[model samples]
Every structure is written in C-alpha cells, then in structure tokens.
Target: MVSFTASAQYGKQKKADTLFNKFSFVKAAEVYKELIENKYNEDYAVRRLADCYALLRDVKNAAKYYKKAVKQDNVPIEYYYNYAQALRGVEDYKGSREWMRRYKDSGGVTSTKNFGKDGNFITSIFNAKQQYFLSKVNFNSKLSDFGAYEHNGKVYFASTRDEGVSVKRLYGWNEQPFLDVYVTEKGSKDPVDHKAKLKGDVNSIYHDGPVAITKDGTTMYFTRNDFFKNVQEKDKKGINNIKIYRATLKDSVWTDVEDLPINNSEYTTQHPALSSDGKKLYFASDRPGGFGGSDIYAVDINEDGSLGTPENLGDVINTPGAEGMPFINNEGTLFFSSDGHVGLGMLDIFATVADKDNKIIDVINLGVPVNSSKDDFSFFMGEDGLTGYIASNRSGGMGDDDIYAYNRVPLLNVEGVVTDAINKKPIANAIITLLDGNNRQIAYMETDEEGYYEINIDRDVDYNITASQKKYEDDSESFTTKNIETKVTTITKNLELNPVQDVVILAELNTIYFDFDKHNIRPDAALELDKIVNLMLNEYPGMVIRIESHTDSRGDLTYNDKLSIDRANSTYEYLISKGIDPARITEHQGFGERRLTNGCDGSVNCEESNHQLNRRTEFIVIKMK
Candidate 1:
C-alpha cells in the first residue's frame, strides 16, 4: 500500500506536469504554487513551473522560481542560463550580465561561440521579438509556375501555361515548366489566374523565366537562349549559352529586343540589373577571367545607350561558389543569393554594402526566419527597403517556389529645402546635411535646380541641419522626428555678405587734360572734382578718403608720374575748399604710363570701351564705427 503523504505528493506533481504539457503555463504555475504551499516536492515543482512560465514569456515569475530552485541546490547550469536570458529579454542588462557571469563561474559554457572567425562579435542587440513576418502571397497553380518582381504597384513575373503563341520547353531534368514574362497589378483578388498575356517578343521557344524590371517598370531584362532553333545541329556545347536581352516600352508596347553587348561568344550572361539612374548595369556572367564559376560584373551605360566593357566585381562579392542573382536596392545595398557562402540554408540570401567605387564591403548573412534549410533565392527588396519579397521552395509554400513577404526596418527619410531669407528665392544646388549633436553627418543631399532635397535618415535619432554656400556663413539648425514618419521642414535664411575694404579710388588723368601736358586740374576737370566732393559728403561723411590719379601709356614714366600727382593734389584741394573737413581728405598717389586696362601694343581688340573697365573710380567701405 502507498503511503498517504507520498501518494498525495505524487498526485499534485502529476497534475502540474499535465498542465504544463498542455501549454497552460499559468495553470501549471498555480498547481506548482499549491504544491509549494503544502511543501510537497517544493524544489522540483518550483523549477519545472519556472520553465513553464519562461515558455509563456513570463520572465518575472520564471526568475523567481529559478532563484528558489538554486536555493534548494542541484540547480543545473541550464536553469541559470535560461534565467539570465530571461532577464536580458526583459532589458535587465546589468542584472543579466551578473547572472551570466555567475553561471559561467559555476563551470558553465555557452553552446555557440560568441565571435566569428573575423573577430567580430555576432550577437544581435536588436530584439527578435520586435520583428514580424508579413502574410505570404499565395500564387495559385495557374500563376504558381512563374518568377515575380514587384514595381510601381504591379507584380511582373514569367509564366507559360498555354498563354503564349510558342510552346515552352522544360530547361532541366527536374521538369520545371518553361515560362514567359507577364505582369499584373498587386491587389487583384483573383490570383492573376486568367490575366491577359504580356505583349511583346517576351517569349521564345526556349526558357525565358527569370526577369528583372527596372524601378519605372519601363525597361526589362530577361534570360533566354537560341538553343532550340539549332537542336538538329551536331555540335551541342555552343547551343546552351543563355544570354540576356533588353527591351524598351514604346506606345504601351515593348519594342526593340536588343542583345546587350556584354554577352560574349564564349560564355553565358544572365540576370541583369540596371541601377536606378540607369547608368550602371550589374549582371551575372559565367565567362572566363572570373573569380569563380559565375561572378557578378558591372558595366557603365553610356549616354547613347551603348554599354562599356564589363568589369568583374572582384572576390569580395564573388566567392569560390557561384554568386548570381545580384540585386541592388535604392540605397545602393547589394542583395544576392549564393550557395557557396556559409549560411543557414543550402542557398541563402546575403547582403553587402556596395560602395561608390562599386566595391563590396561588410558582407552579412541574413539569419533564420528568412533562410531555412531548403533553397531560398531570387530575392527582391521593395523601394521602401523595409519590405522584401523572396522566392523559396521551402515546405508549406503555395508552390514549388512561393513568394514570402517580411518587414524590413527602412533607413529613415530626411527631406527639407533651402531658400534666400530676404527675397525668399529658391537656392538651387544648395548642399544640406543632418548631423548628430556630436557633429557626425547622419544624412546629406544637394538641392535640385528647384531648391528641393529629400534624404533617408535612420529612425529614433536627433540631427542638426547644416546648410552652406560660397559667400555665406554656415547655417546650422536642429530637428527630430518620430520613427517611420516623413518629416517636411523648411529653412529660410539670409546670407549677409561682407564688403571689400581698403580699395584705391582712381581718377583718370586724361580727364584733367592740361594745355599739352600741364600739371594742373583744368576747369572741366574741376567740375568732375566737384562731383567727387559731393560723393564723399554722401557716402563717407566722416572717414578719411584717399584720391589717386593715373595716366595713359604715352608720356615719360617719371615726368607723367609727377604730373598725375599735381593733378590729384589740385582735385583734393578743391574738395577741401567745398566745406569738407581737411582731416577727412588725404593727398593722392599717381601711376603713370603703366597699369593700362588694355595691352599697350595698340590692337583693335584694345578698344577705349575695354579701357573704361580700368579707368573707373572705385570706393571701399573703410570703417563704419
């Protein structure tokens, strides 16, 4: 016969475990509380109940039970680790660190290494709980046999289920059906099941499945081959070279299927991407001189629509394994799918920064939830950068390679304008920037000709806007915005220009015209001198102003210099006689037979009007105070 106390304890323990197994963690915790209330197997029940609460994300109760379990002794290292992780999840970083240290001190080790071989710490500080997966876009069987790309509120993909003139052929032994390019809007209730076929020479006898549409949805680049036309020929090696072709949209129809020059007679080139500006072309090539099997290459698009010679993107982007399907986001971040790279799945999506010089840097593997053990490739990121679409063959998908959507945290959008303060005139090409309080540049852009600029900024940060130009003092303004909101602000400011000072005021000696070179101011010259007196009284009422005179290149340099000085002195005396203070006027210097506005060698180009530019009297603002 069972002892009464032992049987009662056994019954309570069984009830707690049963509730825990059902995922009713709160109920299980209550049962554990009742057992502990009676002091029946208190330690075991408490620890088990802590694990149940932790599974339910009740970290506070989990920590309490874990402490109780440790006090009772025989508490495993996993219990402490779980408790520490729970504390960290609750943002108790300091306490969590202490517990983790204690757990390690108790002869415990983390199962995975914290640092990568590159010596960089790999743990994500961002809470994974804050991330979410959006709804999966299910493509029915009629539309499932295609690859899709979204642009301008439309999804462009390729399909060939008796919707075209030519019968499509299966490319490989896996017997995947060949396809032709098609397009449909985003919010169609019917899964594009019976949409009209895309018009153009988009389909051929061979496979033309994979496609990439430019941001404007006007241009398209797709992969196809001429193999089927020459199938009866003997030599087979040259027939399988799949090449990419470009098409233009004209009059609501795609015309001019032109083969890109980057395609060579020796190897295959496919999966082309045109930059947003349509100036750079990125594509995958299996030609020789590559780093590995297939490498990404880029070519400059000339203004006349011809392509320059292609250059390989080096080993940073390409690896020993094939690095294909290169897609560049609007912010110039590069996303591609590779099988040779180490990742969570067979073929995973990787991201890297594409620098201005077209070099790849800081390659990162997109971790779990985006990548599974199955093949996941053909990724496309939206213009917003926070939403992404990827094609996958993972189980539970709607088709062989279904599309999945996920939320991506976007780089913030910082936009503003620059204008003249007084006139309110729009200043074009004005450089504007947003900097942190520490003066680090967070975002920057130059205003367009219309005096407008928009830049994407990271969220939850403060920044100062700095605007500057030639002949203007730098302007710095500060602003902040809530996360995920488009901020519109304006900066209207005036640039006060400093006047030039210490400039010489020059009078033409020819205007003093004496009787065949006399050294005195003539009557007509005295009238011009009176004009100077009036100008001095009006502009520089109290300042000391200097007068200087100059002669043409005809007279002797020394004699004409003295004549010029006498004429200047005569003019200064007249100004002093006109009730102007003698202290406010000064003696003049002369430059004779030199510093002529025109070259002295007498050419038709040296006209008198040209000399007028040099003959003018100039005034400088000396001291206002």
Candidate 2:
C-alpha cells in the first residue's frame, strides 16, 4: 500500500499539470477556482484564474480575479497593466485610468510617450461621432493590401487573393504570395462571390496595388513593384522601390500604361490622385525635403497633361512616420491614411480640409467602427460628400483587403443678410466675401434677391466678412466660432449709403475729395454734394444745413483757414443752384484740420496712408428739430 504523504503530494502535482495541459482556458479557470476556494495554492490559483478570464474576454471577471491575486501576492507590473486593459474593455474607463495612474506612479514601463491626447486613438475611437462596419470585406489573409478609391458610385482597391495571376513569395513569412488590384460596384451584396479584375495590360508578374481613380473614371493611377526581381538583382532597396503608373480607359479597357515623369530616382512615389477639376495631381512621396518618411505632395497639371514640379504639403498633414494614399472630394475635403498619426491599430484613416490655395486645415481622426484595432486606410468619399468607401483588413472580410461604403451627415451651414444701413432695405447684387483669420478668402457667394446668402463652412474656422456695392460704402464684420458642431449660423448687418444732406452736405471722409495742398472743395466734390441738396428738397422741404471743411497743417495758419472757408462756400453755391434756398442755408466754417480722426499729429514722418486721415469734410446736426 502507498504512504498517505506520498499520495497527497502526487495528487497536488497532477492537479497543477492538468491546469497547464487543458489549454482550454475556461476549463483551466474552473480547476484553479476549486484550488483557491479550498485555500490550496491560493496565490498561484488566483493568478492563473485571472489570466484565463482575460483570454476568455470576460474582462469584468478577469479584473476581479486580478485584484484578488494582487492582494494575495505581489505580481509583476505587466499584470497590473493587463488589469487596466480589462477594466477599460468593460467600459470602466475611470477605473482603468486610475489603475494606469497607479501603475505609472509605481514605476511601470511604457512603450509610448505621455498618455494619449484628445487626438489619440483610444480617445478618438471612444469619442467618434459616427461609426459602422463595411459589411462585405474579408480581413484574415496575410497579404499587405490597401488604398481604395471611389468613383461614379463604384469602389476599387488592391488585393492579393487567389484571383491574382501573379504570385511572388514574401520573406520572413511562410512564403506568402503577392497581391493584385480588384474592383467592386456599389450596392453589391457579396464581394468575393462576384469579384471583377481590373481591365489592363499593366497587371504583370509583379505586384500591382493601391489605386486612385479620377472622378470621370477615365484615368487610373496605382503602385507597382517587382520584389522578386529586385531580390534577384541584389538591390538593397529594390523590394521597397515602388513606382506610380497611369493608364487611360479607352473602348472599356485600360491601355497605354506610362510612368509619371514626377517619379524620380531619388525617392519612391506612389498612390497618385487627380483633383475634381482635373487641374492638379496629388500623390505620396518619400523624397528628400519631406517632413518625414513619406508625405502627400501635389503638382500642377500642365495643359498638355504633364506634371509640373511637385511641392511638399508641409507638417500640417505630414507627420514623422508615413502619410500616404490621399483622396480628395469635389468640396476639397482630403482623406488619407497614416501610420504616423495616433491610431488604434497599425494604420488608420484621417481627414482634413484641402483649401483652394492648397493650405491644410483642421486634421481630424476617423473614430471607431470605421477604425478598429486593425489596419484601416484608403478612404474615398462621393461627390455628395456624405457617402463613400474605405479599404480595411478587419475580420469577416472577403479577402486580405476589402472595400466598404459609409454614409455621412452634412456639416454645418452659415447664412446671413446684408442691407442698406440708412434705409434698412435689402442690398441687391452686393459682393460678399468670406475670409479666415489669416485674411485668406475661404469662400465667396453672391446675395440672392432677398439679400440672403448661405455657405457650408467647416465647424471651427474664424471668419471676417465684408459686403460692397458700387454706389455704397463697404461694410465689414469679424467673428470667431466655437469648435462644437453647429447646425446653422445667421448674421445681419446693414450697409449705410453715401451722404444725401441738403445745402451743405456731409459724407464719410473717404467719399469727399480735396485739393492738393488746400482744403477747398473741388468741382468734382460739389457734384457729389448735390445729392444732399436733392434729398433736403424732397424729404424735408424746409431743411437747412451748414457745410464744414478742414485743411491740413501744410500752409500758414491764416491761409489754411481761408482755404477751408472758400471750400465751404463753394459747396453752398453748388447747393443753391440745385434749388436749395440761400436763406434756408447756414454759413460755413473751417476747422483747419486741427481735429484729425487718426491719433497722429500733422508730421512729415506720418505715412501717406495716415496723412489722408487728416484731410476731411463734415456737416454737423445744427438744426435737426
């Protein structure tokens, strides 16, 4: 018979081995549960049980076990990190944050710099405004494929599935094969079940991927590389020397494949796209003078369809790592893929505004549903700016990369009215211009018959607006907007018409003209003052007015005073000829330019633009009653 002590030790050893062998974490957890419940090997059992729960995706239970294990035994810092992840998975964000804080305070190691900001992946994904899965793409295969373009209600992308004619073995993997390009029509239910190969002579034994099609669908641009051939040639950088090529659709087939001149030997250029108007081309390049590894660049398309010098887009859109595959809609909203920007996975798609002058504005991360803890990029939006496509390697897709369509809501709109300041009537045919804080014109729209105009503006752009008409003075106003999503904004401003006084007319300083060294009113100035005489006779039959003139400090004081008086009398004579009674008109006075509007004393050092401020004409309210 066996000894009781030997049998008890044997039983314990068998139990631990069984927990390690089952690999069925759920069952292993149950076995560990019994050990902990009976106070047998409590520390080991609790830690094992927590790891099992985490593998099972039971985050709440996982956290529970982890807390118990840490209390019983001092576990490694990684255990606490795992516990924080579990808390976050269970939507206990505050708890997760606190746990992370504690871990950091206890001197835990971190892979990245300071915690995520508002633009970071975890924050943006959780705070996304809209998100959904692209129903028909398969994401499990090992091919490196992405970059989708939407044109004329169809989606196109690069893939390396069984349908590819060319197969090249990949290194560092179990001899994985090459990839190719594929196209899918809109409203299709099954993507893989009904795949269509891109029609072209360009598909060779090499890899052909990452396509961008023009709005008219007549032109196509994509990347091509011969990794196998380059490897054989022993070219150190051959495997990554991808080049961009263009093809035209003629007779329903892509032909005449040609290399773009913009592709230089200095760097690899790929993922080319054409603007909506076909006037400019945008693409990704890792050439020298870029902000970092790779950045989106653009060039003007010549009349003969050749490219001009390419210009780097700068730090606004490009980061320190990689920025590629840019897609721009008709409204100038730019969509691109970046591994450099903060994201939830290997790569994520982002968006920003590509202004008319090619300035980048308002970079925004596309949050969850559209982006996950997987590779997602190559986005294309429709002309309507709301519906479009994306290429992702998420689960349940048709192949290594698949295309998806998304529906988006329209952004905010701004509307305002411009009117005559004096009459408060709608001003017709006024030129309304909208400028940003930098004084650059963002958009310009003309007022309709009712003097109302509307513009679709992004959420947070500061604006300065102005309206001008031929016969009236210009009116301007400035306002800054909040970052919140506002549905509509309305502003009303009245533009004042020029002077219309009676005997001695007064106008805004800018309207009246003065002689070269004298404040005496010129003949041309009298013609403008006549409008005031006409208004007095028609609106106030018995109204009288005094004309006032001012002179600069250029001449003797007495002579300057005399010149101002002569100018005012010249205005009075002109008003009387226009049927204004001399008896009803008051005499004139000269201020000799003593009181200037601007805070500058009459000095030679004052600039011409400022000196103009001192020369003016005015009429006071002497008899309003």
The prediction achieving the highest TM-score against the true structure is: 2
Cα lDDT, model 2, residue 86? 61
Each candidate structure's TM-score, on Cα atoms with residue i matched to residue i, is: 0.46, 0.48
lDDT of 2 by residue, 71-167 (tens): 6556777666666656655556566657766666778753233234422447646755453445544422345446656667665666665343354
Tell how far residue 423 is off in model 2, in angstroms. 7.4
Kindly report which residue pairs in candidate 1 clash with one another.
386-408, 412-456, 412-457, 413-457, 414-455
Q: Per-residue CA lDDT of candidate 1, range 431-499, in tens?
A: 787787678976676778866777655556677777765423456667665443432332233222221
Candidate 2 TM-score, true structure as reference: 0.48
Tell me the TM-score of model 1.
0.46
